[model samples]
Target chain A: MLDPQIIIAGVLNGLLAGGIYVLVAVGLTLIYGVLHIINFAHGSLLMLAMYAVFFLWRLAGLDPYVSLPLVTAGAFAVGFVLYRLVIGRFSHGKDENILLITLGVSIVADNLALLFFGGDTQTIDVPYAGDIIQVGAAFLPLPKVISCGAALLICLVLGLFMTRTDTGKAIRAVARERQGARLVGIDVEHVFAVSYGIGIACLGAAACLLMPTFYVTPQSGYAFVLVAFTIVVLGGMGSFLGAAVGGFLIGITESLGGLFLGEQLGQIGISLIFILILLLKPTGLFGSRA
Target chain B: MRHLALAAALLAAVVYPLLVPNYLATVGMLMFFTAFIGQSWNISGGFAGQTSFGHAAFFGVGAYTSTILQVTYGWNPWLAWPAAMAMGGLVGAGIAVLSFRAGLRGSYFALITLAFAEVFRIAANSASITRGGLGMLIKADQRPINFQFKDQIWIYYLAFALCLVSLLIAWWLTRSRFGARLVAIRENEDAARALGIDVFTEKVKVLALSGAMCAAGGTFYAQKYLYIDPNIAFGIDKSVEMLLVTMVGGAGTIFGPLIGSIALTTINELTRAAASVFPALKNVQPLSLIVYGAMLVLIVARLPDGFASLLGRRRHA
Candidate 1:
């Protein structure tokens, strides 16, 4: 018998968490779908995006919400360049090689961030930082709601882009068969770059949106990445729809578990869920076994 | 000749700790423990190609089981060690059965292990008996039955013996039929299955064996230090250190984790010492991590078979 008010609060938090999970897992899945690499640096890119929002807000007095577009654009450019120069070389090899290369990229990014920023927590100064909205018996934070909304919008837009656009078709073609896509005269390289760029852009958008609510730090991405990995696995590796649903499920479970079992146990609950899902469904909920 | 090599290696291991200063002795002990754990990891990860990144689950399970039994039930520390090792094996088998049944192999297998470790860490952090993040600290005093010792040499010997046991187990497994099956499965699971190898059974067996060894390492670690914290017990860093060492030295080869562990541990000690001396260089600590990461990339890129293969090729040539 949970309190109705507490339940609503949990739902809100879960929704917000799910939004972030979707954002993180979508990027991971997108990269994996095209390149077949988990892209361990995906989390590092998110950290970079968080820093971008923080600096933009801190240095220029720009609201993180307003700077989201620029961050997305910047992430796209960096991701494009990274794929072209580094990831491209590792793309055509044993999968383990990609894992190692991405791991290297992640290590470099994390250490570089640590070197530059020092290993301390920094946050963007958001207006209405302490403000809350009372919904009937439940209080909801404005920042989380906004972030979730933005996340949903991004997911929708990305879904449309993937389904409707000519470039999106080419990307899907490559994902299905790289050799076949090449045979069809499609620029597989460009598709790889664009897919990676879009993936990073999603992370960039998430970072800017999240900056208002969470603290930005070098190691902050580790927990986020781990959680996102769980969600991605639950959703089925490379399934966009699965990532979205898995995100919400994880968020709800995390928030509800936090409320019932306490914060520390809540974290363990998520990890247990991952193990349980992995042990139960090898193909994942949405993953199609070809 | 084999016996002679063993005697020589044992002599070097025993005497080196005594020759080194106390600080260096401690570092050597740490390296020995790391090597043991890395060898344990190598059994399942390297030999079986499971890539389990969550040996910390077994490590923590061992530490907690023994620590709690010794402190609460007033069990003898020596008795608790076997209990811990057994518990580790059981848990390892459980994890193997669960994960393998679900088709979790390779990277997915690694992910599951990491998830389990995280779960264990969180559980330890929350459980009241384990002191719930305040951690467990044994009274630091010299008592033989208590398994507490003031002299670094005693702890050094104990860790050294544990390392020997671990290495022996790894070697024994390598020469066993189980080891052959594991190698076959690692090379190609489908082909192995076709060739009448019980792939799942071999994987689970290797995972359990590795888990037991790692757990024993954890138990000894807790006894020596007389302190057990959830963060250290179920740390991702500990798991990574094991993997990095094995990968660097050579996977799927006898004595690879031994070499990797010693080399990496020494490097870690140097990095930590350097970082402390040059407080201005806080980021210097990450230099080792960066190098380790780069090494992983290079090994995967150029030397997929690891350092052992390079040595073997040189010998053959």
Candidate 2:
């Protein structure tokens, strides 16, 4: 017989994991949707943001939560520059070339982080790091709860912003049909930059919010990125609703898998699930193409 | 002209081990092996245009199979090598059959492969047969069954020979019908499919063959090192290095990966040597990665066809 509290706790954890997935997955999908290039280095950008938060905390003594805006800005600037200098040059090009370029960016960023920060995992010892909230018979860590809250807030805000803003509408236009958007006097280049910027900012925010709950390391991005990719694929690339919904599904599946199976098995199980999803639905559950 | 080029390449490879310093000899061996991996990658990724990111799965399969056989059954490492390679190829074939059957190509195919590699890595880490994370260590130091080397020179020589054989195979593959189909699929899969070419089957066949070739490389790698660990065998860095070699030198050409390997490996060795003196540079072991990334960007931006195309042009000129 399974513990009822364990199930509840798993659901909560899943919801949190799902929220983070949505944030990372959205960025990946958006870039892929607009540019038709899968940003293999998406995780590296997330890593950069985590490090940004680390430095802010260590140097400026700013709280991780308080530094969200700063990290968001930093991520945006990085994305904008990358688009203007690197991606802008390759815009409207072959997809493989773009994929390779993004992969290169990922490699550069990962190694740079490794070089400067060393291959060590660092964490912020926040005041609430040790705090936990007891839910009936189950206990939830406070940091995870906060991370989940931040993830939800970020997604909701970004979703609203994308749907509400004219810039956002242009971005959507670009994603849905590039040639059509270009003919309508929409600055496709600027739209590309803004969408890419928003996507990077989303990942950046995720990295910062996750710092309190998880340690930051140069190699950490690979793990998260893999999961995020799985979520993106499962959620259907470029589908915002799919990303949000897929995040929770994967998170819950992961939590339940982790609790029932061992930790290692849980991770493997998710990977297997990712492969299955690809096989069953190449366009994804909510993919636009299919 | 091709024969002359091949002869020249063989000459360089044969003499390389003798002329290079010990550290360089080791790097040379790695470069050769990596070149082999890259060439094999090109069969599927470049020629077939599959772009599998999970090649480490095949590599790990080869290493683990060889290691387990050598350790448990006391099989001669040489005899077990072919068997180990076959297992990896078989797995690759299985993956191809499944993935390509669904018409999953390009990024979708690459993601699936990546996931499979991660799955294999995690499973290997937890499996008792792999000794879990402890991995497999040789019981004897220098017995023929042990596959342990008393000197690095021997391993270098063996790796060099394997490299030559792999290059020859890669050359033959490019001229073969299967290779032609792979290239056709790579250039335009939909057109190939329309013309009665079984694109899915061709992709799987090439991927399987490439997996086998990579597995052969992995078998030798494990046997030479006489140690096999999940992380080392299934590392993403290995996959990246293979891609770097192909991308840097030329993807479709026969000797592209080989040239890329030599150039990149030499630069890496140079950086490593510099690191020994500077110390700070040593901490940044991944600086080469940045260079690799930059080179990738440059290649995509300037010459999408790769450096080999430049050589081809010069030849035609």
Clashes of each: 0, 1
Q: Indicate the DockQ of the complex predicted as candidate 2.
A: 0.74
Cα lDDT tens digits for candidate 1, B1-317: 65897799889888997788898898888888888888888888888887876889899889988999988888888899889999999999998998888776667777788888888899899998898898898666588777877787888888787778877777777899888888899888999999999888888888888888888988888988789999999987788778888888888787788788777777777778888998876677577777777777677666776777877787678
Per-residue error (Å), model 1, residue A152: 1.6
Q: In candidate 1 chain B, where is summed lDDT lowest over 10 consecutive residues? A: B297-306
DockQ in order: 0.61, 0.74
Clashing pairs in 1: none
Superposed model 1: Cα runs more than 4 Å off? A91-97, B1-10, B272-279
Tell me each candidate's TM-score. 0.94, 0.96
Residue-level lDDT tens digits of model 2 in A1-290: 67887789888888877777788888888888887778888998899899999989999998888998889888998998899898877644656667778877888888899988999888887898889998777678887888888888888888788789998889889988889999999999899888888889888888778888778888877887788888888888878888888888889989988888778767787798789988888778888683
Residue pairs in candidate 2 whose N, alpha carbon or C atoms collide under 3 angstroms: A18-A247
